[model samples]
Target: MHDFCFAIPYGLILMTGGVLGYAKKGSTASLAGGLGTGFLLLLAGFLSLKAFKKGRNSYLAMILETGKPVFGYRGMVYAQSS
Candidate 1:
């Protein structure tokens, strides 16, 4: 139910897709976009998990999980709009 739970899996999926795209079609864009976004999400997920262990929330993870709005301000709104 936590953000990290989804973010981690999503990140892994993105990363795998990126690698597959590059391997199957040599698409640099896909590789870059997928890998970059995936890495950010994965890092954010880890941060969230760490915070959860300490009984805290990770705004950074929440922001990234929601499409990573500017400075995380209005992230939920942006996510909804998108």
Candidate 2:
């Protein structure tokens, strides 16, 4: 539910761009681009949710939830605090 909630809006924006491109120039490439981008974002959101489920207190999730940079490493990844 959480992943879907985030993915839907992102997908809608991309889909709208694709529709606009098609309307403006009738290019199939524009339509494809929009669909591709939206799908990628949706996938990313779903993956993030899975990560959250596995590690509710994971460093990445903490930083993302707090909307702030956190220093130190979670495995090989490090975020520089600001």
Candidate 3:
């Protein structure tokens, strides 16, 4: 289940590139476009995953340090007065 979360995007990008590559008349431009799109998608996915992990770690640390949840589903946090 967790693995699929990562695998799905790669699979979709590969399939999309394949389709685009095939649609073009075997020209260099088509191949280039497909490869470029695939590369950019991969790069974006990698960066997003890294950011998500970092954010989750930061949120967890904040919760531990503050001894309270940082935000609710509604994106509101209660402030405590010292």
- Count the clashes in each prediction: 0, 0, 0
Tens digits of per-residue lDDT, candidate 3, 1-82, equal: 3322553386467647656776766656556545554544455455545556666333332232233223221233233322
* Most lDDT-accurate candidate: 1
Whichever of 1 and 3 has more TM-score, that candidate is 1
Per-residue accuracy of model 2 over 16-69 as CA lDDT, tens digit each: 898899899998977886776665565555656776778653444333433311
Runs with alpha carbons beyond 4 Å of true place in candidate 1: 69-82
lDDT, each prediction: 0.84, 0.59, 0.47
lDDT of 2: 0.59
Ranking by lDDT: 1, 2, 3
Model 2 poorest 10 in a row by lDDT? 67-76
lDDT value for model 1:
0.84
List the pairs of residues colliding in candidate 1. none
